[model samples]
Target: MSGPRIDPSLYRERDRIPIRRAILSVSDKTGLVELGQALAAAGVELVSTGSTAALLQEAGVPVTEVASVTGFPESLDGRVKTLHPAVHGGLLADLRLEDHERQLDDLGIRAFELAVVNLYPFAETRASGAPAAEVIEQIDIGGPAMVRAAAKNHANVAVVVSPDGYDGIRRALAEGGTTLEQRRALAAAAFGHTASYDRQVADWLAKETGERDRVLRVEATLAAPLRYGENSHQQASLYTFAEGRGIAQAEQLAGKEMSYNNYVDADAAVRAAYDFERPAVAIIKHANPCGVAVASAKTVDPIASAHIRAHECDPVSAFGGVIAANRTVTLRMAEQVADVFTEVLVAPDFESDALAVLSRKKNLRILRLPADYRREGWEFRQISGGVLLQTADSFDAERGSAQHDSSGWRLVSGEEVDDATRADLEFAWRACRAVKSNAILLADGGASVGVGMGQVNRVDSCHLAVSRAGKRARGSVAASDAFFPFSDGLQVLLDAGVRAVVQPGGSVRDEEVIDAAKRAGVPMYFTGERHFYH
Candidate 1:
């Protein structure tokens, strides 16, 4: 493994290295001809690989093929093109080091002042859902080797990995040469580009082979700088996953810039509203759902009606809350939405008239969901010294799908309910999971009448729900995210004239809870599945 001896004292320091020769090999042909022409006009030698050399020669630019320098033709379907020592030695030779210069001169290898390389489209090929073999072929071997070699010897060479840097490289060449600082910055960027590309390939291979990475490679690019963090005094920024389909990809149709809180509440609203099969709307405030509702079959304007009912659940809290709708926003929805002092509204799309109406409210943020948006993958939460990862809370109850399996549900007490009340209980159960625990939700006519969330005790949550619902709780069905430790919470709902209840019954005092429901003559169903959100 030992290759050569090092003599630090014999190495000289240089500020700017004149670029007399450049190696350019790119899979992306964008701006390649122009860069070649400019380098030729500047009297710089251009050495390129197969197709790149052909394109430059066709454009009337003088160029030398990499095969001519290596004395070996590109073999193994071009996979072995730039892996030879001639290319790497030229790229990695430290002209400041006397030994390195002597080795290059004795070997008849010309040192390259610049290396421009962009890897093949591995990420794009994988994203296109191409076959495994096709995706594998797009993983460039020689390109990364060249980029890393040039970046490692940044003191003697500059590397460019993207077309965006072509202009800067051209300007640097026009200025005689690139400064050491410029080379260092380019080296850092080049390494990052290769790192992200490798991570993508590794992650995809892991998924295809049904294996998990022992060491996670998390990568994100800076999307924007937020005005502040959770509070005004704190600093914050937004980093987006390159292939994410969540809030980061949402398009703002019309509105002011999104704040930190706006994105948080908007994301929560979207998740809550999309839980239903029918047209639904969820109003969220401070990362908690203020109200949630779904439209009935007879509704005239489904989204508008759902929004109206959801807002009515807690009109006071919904004043400046964010709204998310599962369906498109129509003119009717826009008119009703404009009447309220809302902060943000996100939906799949907006009708022409609806957009015109919503655009009038300059301060109201209007976001359109990405067409292919879907909730998938894992959820990550960071703690003081570690991170927690789990699969997302997803179910088979997607929109337009068959109803979720209810064979696991058991009617523990009271008489069996009609179809209408059963539908209400089902809606309440799904909505309750989105609320923070200890959570209690009341539903009637496919809409939330009251919601009690984030309480320390189930009994307090029950009381809060009843208090918020007032008279509406009389005929509403109740859903608890988890089982009641005692009968006190069920008693509270029963006392408010709640007609039926749905909960995950697994407490030691389950019989006691069942007795209380039986005495109230209220139907109680145990799903045996608990959902607790914190």
Candidate 2:
């Protein structure tokens, strides 16, 4: 298993190797022309392939084509251009080893001191629903090969793989080449780039061809470096996929930068807000909603009323929590929000006057999302060493679709369900879907009055909700994510003055629970569906 043994004599203290020649081949030519000019001005030879060389030539920078370097014309539609030994040997040579240098000289292989390569847009191509031929063509061969070679020889060669890195590379070369530390960092990035590129290709091929690969690979690029994670002791960064916009893409219009917990809790807040088509607001603390409320139609100032009622649900817990509104934030809403110690706020848009008022809170993190911003694609959650993927829970119970939706909800007992109660039950059920396990969500009229979660017993969750809502528990509809295994939970809700209930009623004691609802004179509906989140 052992390969070549290292010679201690080869180790020597020296400065960075002068970047004498660079091989540049990129699908993303951003900053390419300027970099070529800077390298040429610094007396560095530029060798490129295909349109890259043509671009440099057009820009008046001297560029030697790969065909000229290898003494072979590009064949197979430019695929064979950089596969030549002349291109790879130049990138992989270890200047520290005398034998490597001798082999390079004897074989007339030019050692490339720098390599700039960004591979074909395979991920973009595959994501765009491109045909098999187009996706196959985007599986870059020579680009990854050269990137790996240059990265493996990090001691003497510097590799650049991202356009974001172009400016720094140019500045380094112009200021006196790259440092050993920087080269090592670039080498690590290069390996990661090729590995991610290959992973995307593998994923696309396996899924498109219906080959169920056992292993899972999730790839994403760095979005932002967070100030800290959930705690000050931990480090964290944000990563985003190539497809759609997420919390990382939200604009920080006028506030301090968001931390790790801010992004996490903010996403929860916004999701709860988006679930409601009406003017809604969600107040979240520790990834759980403290209160969620929608403005009543009778309110003259809907946004302000939504915020005030949501905060009233649990004013103590709403303190320092993230708040999100599906509607534009108005000056009146801003004035009400400023009265509380809100840590973060997210809105579709903000009136200029609202921003003028909210900007006074220097520590408050405010974010603005496009009115149409919504998440698409799969949901991913990581365990110890693997990932769990599923389509997001886009299951919103249509206002009256419950009668026709497969899991058709029907009234099971007690008084006839009124329209107002039905609307409130729907709101509570939607909010309950977002709560943690053993959840019991209570809604008064249209606002989320109380939320009880993370309990081992359903009865205890009922107790928590009743206690949280206080007097508001009277006449408020309740939603239990799953069936009440025992009738005791239903009795507890009834004792707290809950008039109606919604739950997925399929349990060993379903008859007993329905009997309990009937005896308590409460209207109960069986959704024929359960929503348990942990």
Candidate 3:
């Protein structure tokens, strides 16, 4: 007899056999007792295994054990229980074939018309960080075998993989018995469930055994469907990785539906907020940091500075931008943010008064993230017919040495730096690390005043930075994401009255640039690190 083909259309045909026999097995056991009782009330025979059989028997439900059907006791620590031909043959045999019916009769094998099976708690076991032996023991073999058999024969056997499907199964059995279309859907779910389970096992083993060649396992769920793509007419949806902390998991307290651009800019802004230790805010536009500021509690309100400085950087560009706050949103902060027309606002939390004020504008999206939330793992991007994955930009300046630190770093030629000048230099260094490629940033007393991003030439970016700062560029510290190729860029910044500068200091003409700063009466620091975002 040929194996049963799992086809939904076959089950939906007018002439179809109703499911009369079912095999039930699960690791979770949730709702199993009630489901068994319902099946019994429907006059369906129940065949279970191991603990499941014992549980059903204790509950006064009739159940046939796999060993009883196979006429062999479960051996090899229950690993060899359901692998017998008597079990799989019954599920795989085509019920509509006369020769298959004769073969089953000769072997005295009863066909299993339905199967409800779930694998062991592999994810839960690995998450517990248990002993290696214990984790290995939890790796199930017989469960997957039975599930695959049932799913592969879904045309004749209904396959159920989740407890959530119990109600649907019960309803079908109560009304007109299981239909072929329902069985086919259950078969698809069964395959997906087993695939996910196997992937988890592979990932866990790779981590435990340190296998370098194993494929990385990734799982994600849909966050929401966006209204459109980059434009209004395109199609798009948001999906977030399931393994770690991410912005997709943030709680939406009171807000409108988030758009495609909102998610893009919001991710950029939140990453910038994590770069600072003090009270800070980052305003992002088109996936780039347009304005970022760090203000002392007494000197200036960080939230107010964020709105003002971001707008000042590029008033035309700040329109419809995404705003993010590392701290909770206060009433004062809400008022300042409300002044500007923004697409979304994300913060750790929002005060009642702040929410009340912001609610007046119904279209603005407000997201409340937990205070201690931190990003995890790497990010994945899809290209044309391929995928690109890399570690996320999860860098914390306070925790370790900046990536640019190197032995080549030295004060080639600059004015003798004072204590205050060095402090400003470090502040400028941190600010520069947050900017994009060919980046130039100007800050005074740790507050970012001007920024230039995505310029092809470093000198052009320097000019743009100074131009944006205008009068504010004077007496401010300047930082470049990369080492200046020539001394001309330093001259432009010095001519603008930039008091100090910080950079990676790797250019071959480093001596010339340092000499230029020293000649211009400016103090410079070489952090031996460069941060260039593309």
> All candidates' TM-scores?
0.92, 0.90, 0.84
Alpha carbon deviation, residue 14, candidate 1 (Å): 3.8
Candidate 2: where is the Cα deviation over 4 Å? Answer: 1-14, 220-244, 298-302, 370-391, 396-407
RMSD values for the candidates in order, in angstroms, are: 2.8, 3.2, 4.1
Pairs of residues clashing in candidate 3: 11-180, 404-528, 404-529
Minimum summed lDDT over a 10-residue window in model 1 is located at 398-407
Q: How far out, in Å, is residue 32 in model 1?
A: 3.6
- Predicted candidate 1, C-alpha RMSD: 2.8
Instruction: Report lDDT (Cα) of residue 146, candidate 2.
Output: 93
lDDT at position 106, candidate 3:
93
Error of 1 at 293 (Å): 1.3
> Could you tell me the TM-score of candidate 2?
0.90
lDDT of 1 by residue, 1-534 (tens): 976787778879887878899999998999999988888888899999988899898999999999999999999988889888899999999999887899998999999999989999999999898999999999989999999999999999999999888898889878988999999999999999999988888998899999988876778899999999999999989888888888888999888999999998998999999888799999998888889999866978999999999988999999999999999999999999999999999999999999999999999999999998877577888899888888777445543223254556899999999999998999998889889999999999999999999999999999999999999999999999999999999999999999899999999999999999999899999988888888
Query: How many Å off is the CA of 330 in candidate 1?
Result: 2.0
lDDT of 2: 0.87
Q: Candidate 3 lDDT, tens digit per residue, 1-534?
A: 984465544333333456688888899899999999999988899988999999999999999998888889999888788888888988887776666778999988889888889988888878798888888888889889889998987778888888999998888876767777888888888988889888888877777778853465667767788899889999999887645455776777666888788887887888887667777788888877777776644544566555565456566666788888887778888998788788888888888999998888787889887655777656677789877777655345443655422223356555656766565566566656667789998887656677888899999999988988889999988888889999998899999998888788888998898889878877677767677777
Better of 1 and 3 by lDDT: 1
Question: How many backbone overlaps does candidate 2 show?
Answer: 1
